[model samples]
Target: MSATATADLISRAQSGDHDAFRALTAPHVRELQVHCYRMLGSLQDAEDALQDSLLTAWRGLDRFEGRASLRTWLYKITTNRCLNARRSAARRRAHEWDIPGVHPPDPTRLGEVVWLEPLPDALVAGGVDALPGPEAHYERVESISLAFVTALQLLPRRQLAVLILRDVLGFPAKETADMLDSSVESVTSALKRARASLDRQRLSNPDREPPPAPRSRSEQELLATFVRAYEAADLEAVVALLTDDVFISMPPMPYEYEGLDTVAEFCARIFRAGRRFELVPTRANGQPAFGTYLRTPDGTSNGVGLFVLTLAGDRISAMTRFEKGVLPWFALPRSLPARGGLPGSRP
Candidate 1:
């Protein structure tokens, strides 16, 4: 429907028409969920907060005032919900090496903040261009990237909200003020501080161009080689495919490996422990990803974790690994039947 049609739906919904509300909300769902994800850093939390925001919007329809567009009205609710959720965000600290049946090598250092989740780009397809304001400074896909989102998580809650609203979503400071129920001055100040903090934490991207979309011919070949080398246990081939300064990190567990030799050593430790992984092709945070299933003593491939790669030409520059609880979101099997469902895919 056109903007006029959407406005009509909003009007009807404001008058208590539930069907009109659903029609008006359909276009905004995906983007709203992503906003929550960026704010909360967890898909499950984002989904919950989005649902709550929708309900709050429905109940408070009459209070929307119509000064802002319906889209902005909905975002006001979502942003608030995410802020409340962030109040309880868990802090991850230095952890002792602890996997029951698997002995991983000692980590270089413990992670300071709770790890952020990777967003599936498919969930963000049309929602991308459809949401950004003409004035947005950051790239939408980069804003949702694992490194970017994780950096965002390090900002204080209010600063985080202001940055996402003003920079990422391209909302005006005045509109963000309304969303946060604060004055524009407060929003501006928060945004200033947020941007400065973010600048201090920003990761250097030597690859000037962004990564290609998932399943592109080049990405497919790169992913295939990575899987082959990883599965075959050929550290040399794997090393060849890695950038000279490649980084590997696992979130929520606080272990990071950087440089060729360090990453190789970390991999060697895991491989030495005899843990075999089968990677189910997937994508996340606008990059290539794999749902990894660790082979068990019973010969079944059990879900363990997922890793997404950052590419620079044909070499991988970074790898962000997330726990397997996100597999279902990618439509991957939790556990594959031994010798049958498992793809010869090893990563």
Candidate 2:
């Protein structure tokens, strides 16, 4: 709806017009959810925050003067809610790291936020409508990458908010200041800190190649090679698909393996463990991903993790393996049957 039409609807909704309110708010729901996901790093949390924000928006419509657009007003509510939720909560959830009795090498670094979750591409594929607003420094798709989101979690609450608002969402410092109920100087300072923190992470940054938009041809080929190489237990083949600077990090554990050789050697250990895996393709964080089921010594397959890939051209630049329990969030089955196609995957 045009701004004028949305304003008219907002006016009606303010006067107990529930239908008008829904109409006015529905258009922003997807973007708000994305915003919330960026803030909290978990889709479920984002939904909860967004739901609460919408209700709050409905009730507080009387206070929403015409000075700011409805989108901006709603974002302020959602961001604040996420901030509060983040402050009181443990961002990472603890889970068993490896197959029972089978441990990979000591992690390269212990990960801080273990509970990061994936956002499905279906929600992100704006298709013809997915253009970034003029101010967006990060591509809408790139902004949601697991690496980017994970890096985002490392920032202080205020810095994280500033970075997302100013860099990803393209909100100006003045607008961000008003949203946070702070001075523009404070917002600017926070953004600088956030950028510095993100730069320090050495993952996704302006220097890196822009992330492929969703599933580009190069990304798909890399993903296919990954599945084939992994399933076949071909170390050389697997190594061939990774970029020289490829990294593999298992979140919730800071142990990160950087560089192709380093990551390949680490993965080779898993292959040498006599474990076999089956890959079922899926999408997460607007990138190619797989449901990885490890075949145990018992000959039964078990859901181990959901591995997401970040691609640069035909090479896999980075990969992250999240908790196995996150599969259901992507509508993927929690467990897959064994190689025989029987339901062999145990939790």
Q: Top model by lDDT, which number?
A: 1
Candidate 2 lDDT, 1-347, residue by residue in tens = 77788778978998999999999988788888888888888887888888989999999999988798777888899899899989887665555565554556655566777767888777766421334456668866668878888888888999999899888888877888999999999998888888888778876545557555556676666677778788878999989888888878776555678777788788888878777787788988878888888766556567778888887766778888877877887777866654454433323
What TM-score would every model get versus the actual structure? Answer: 0.89, 0.87
**Cα error, candidate 1, residue 233 (Å):** 1.2
| RMSD to native, candidate 1 | 3.0
lDDT of 1 by residue, 51-128 (tens): 999999999987877788888988888998888888865544444444445556555655655446778877867457
lDDT of 2 at 187: 92
lDDT of each candidate versus the true structure: 0.80, 0.79
Q: Considering every candidate listed, which one attains the maximal TM-score? A: 1
Clashing residue pairs in all predictions, respectively, total 0, 10
Q: Which stretches of candidate 1 lie over 4 Å from their true place?
A: 89-102, 206-214, 296-299, 340-347
- Which stretches in model 2 have alpha-carbon errors above 4 Å? 126-133, 204-214, 295-302, 336-347
